[model samples]
Target: MTLSDTNHAATLALRALAWTLGEPARAERFLALTGLSPDVLRASAGDPSTLAAAIGFLESHEPDLVACADAIGATPQDLAEARRRLDA
Candidate 1:
């Protein structure tokens, strides 16, 4: 992804994580790591990086975060399957 896209992703991921896990501590740490403010996170709806960083952070703390590879409760294998489908 482009630099802007990466930043945008980072923004969205955080929002999803904040909403999904209801973990403000994780979200705040992600914001700090990515140099994003609360306003920016609110503005970007679904940037991959935002989601990615949040997941990444959570994964470090709790590997089960891998279970959410898909947007709607997809497992890690499901994510691989989705990728396979996309690449086909």
Candidate 2:
């Protein structure tokens, strides 16, 4: 991907991550599901794998994916595309 595309993907991933952590229950669930400790999450916030994992978590549940997309001013497709780019 181009640098701009990569940047956009990164931004979307970060936003998705924020949305995931915005609620205590969701955050706890995310941590449990991903097996990522808070320290690891914080330390690797900018890592592509971490970012992709965040989006992946959202993608795993359609309701959450759609809800998060709405909350973050993005479409679910946008988030999926972002995840693809991050994976690439």
Candidate 3:
């Protein structure tokens, strides 16, 4: 479940965020749940906090987590570990 095949965890988190936000509905849902505005997302996409939030967004729901993991060619655990590392 390592992210050895991908970029660093922070980068992977951003990739997951982009995947979650690719659909307007999904993006809107993420914003609603996380209280993050598009401006803020754009501004802090590189921050550890933002990356952690994005991974948390994916981790909150099984369907989204699995889908995001698959989309990014990673396992769900990898994303979770990535989040933990970023937060630490």
TM-score of each: 0.45, 0.98, 0.90
Model 3 TM-score (2 dp):
0.90
Model 2 spans > 4 angstroms off: none
lDDT of each: 0.51, 0.96, 0.88
Task: Write model 3 residue lDDT over 1-88, tens digit each, in one string.
Answer: 3455334887789889999999999999999999999998899889888899989988888899999999999999989988988887
Residue 72's lDDT in candidate 2:
93
| Global local distance difference test of model 2 | 0.96
Q: Write the per-residue lDDT of candidate 2 for residues 1-88, one digit (tens) a residue.
A: 8999999999999999999999999999999999999999999999999999999999999999999999999999999999999999
Task: Candidate 1: list runs displaced more than 4 Å.
Answer: 1-16, 19-21, 63-72, 76-88
Residue 5's lDDT within candidate 1 is 47
Q: Rank the candidates by TM-score, best first.
A: 2, 3, 1
Better of 2 and 3 by lDDT: 2
- Which residue pairs of candidate 2 clash? none
